[model samples]
Target: MKGTMVALGGGGFSMSEDGASALDDYILAMTKRPRPRICFIPTASGDADTYSERFEAAFRDRADTSVLSLFCHEPWGYSDPAMLLEQDVIYVGGGSTANLLAIWRLHGLPEMLEKALDSGTVLAGISAGMNCWFESSSTDSYGPLAPLDDGLGLIPGSACPHYLSEPRRRESYQHWVATGALADGFAVDDYAAVVWRDGAFVEAVAEQRDRPVFWVERTADGVVEREIPVRLLGQ
Candidate 1:
């Protein structure tokens, strides 16, 4: 049992049509460590306090978890040694990418997360959270697609989540073709997530009932799209 890595969509909690058990199972599958102290980065949690509370309540009955929401208005404690070492999971919430990256680099979290992953720490997040894992992606909901000015690069290429619900899949694919900055990328729909291990996706968790996970990658000629049903143990 190796550690887990996850990327979430915007609808993670009550917003999720998928049952809570499915998400828990995904979390369980992601980590071999029990009662892991999870870090929830709600930099993208938005200004709605109620939504944030709802977001936190989503992870119910996990007594060992610790939530740390970074405030972009605050200064970075750049000198702290165990700044991010105490947690077992890093969860970023959905918000503006520009803001998330600005605060992340200011606080020097990119290096922190990379080192954490090296030690087998789990990473998870929705929307902006998921996008940070890729080299760069569509900054806007539309096709104003561009390489992330500041991406952690935890995962190479690009990731375009909310694939089917929003019109991001085709837009992302177009960007990949036009720029050639990103060769292959994932365009995951809502209530679905893909877990990448080493370099390739070895496991997938589909919280949705019918919606599939779209794995779109670019070839020398053009972009290719394939829809795969979500399962716990996927290859």
Candidate 2:
């Protein structure tokens, strides 16, 4: 079965405060299941309680929400990675991309996520969550924006989230792609998400108007970039 993944640059149920719930609403609709089982993975922030609590509050009444914490200490080797594969949707939160990758690798979550995807789970996330899906991405893991070459590679190219929020993000991603430091990839503005189905680009979605996703690649002449139109949701 073909599965879907929505990689959000920023702005979602947990981040937006202007009564803007469009992106999260879209995620819910994507599940195509009543009371869909949605799991939140917050390992990026060291499985911090506050982040998980924010997630729970945002999704509490919207779906059947649960959190899978990988770093809990209290005989808390309690979570089964297998549970991740059972959900209808998996949402990852933003944080240190490098640390997240390292921890996920330690727990074999990358493999489990792939299995979950194959089972038609709708995977989604913002920032670090978005970066994890690509072959590589521009990240702030090293204190300044830099290219991260190893990713889950579920998507075939690189990606940059928070393209608009972070001033250096666009330039860094473009330079990396142009210098052969990173493969050709996509980038998205805040509040925007690039959607993929069966690992193919479908379209971009945004909670706000005019937020676009870009395709960037190295060209003989220089780096080439173009905006991919985004469909505004929750209008």
* Strongest candidate by TM-score: 2
- Per-prediction TM-score: 0.80, 0.95
Judged by whole-model lDDT over C-alpha atoms, candidate 2 comes out at 0.87
Runs in model 1 lying further than 4 Å from the true structure: 1-3, 17-21, 46-48, 72-83, 141-149, 178-181, 232-235
For candidate 2, lDDT tens digit of each residue in 1-235?
2579999999897676633478988888887877889998888888877777777778777688888888873323449889998899999999999999999999899999999999989999999999999889899988999999889989988999998788888888888999999999888999899999986889898988878889997999979999888888854
Provide the lowest-lDDT 10-residue window in model 2. Answer: 69-78
Q: Report the lDDT tens digits of candidate 1 across residue range 1-235.
A: 2345687654466355332546545665566665666656666544345545554566645525444545422222123424467776766777677778887786777777777777777778777888888877656623364555356667766777777777655675566645576646677777778787765666557765765676666666666777765784332
* Candidate 1: clashing pairs of residues: 4-30, 44-94
State residue 9's C-alpha deviation in candidate 1, in Å: 3.5
Candidate 2 displacement at residue 72 in angstroms: 0.7
Candidate 2's C-alpha runs over 4 A off are 18-20, 73-77
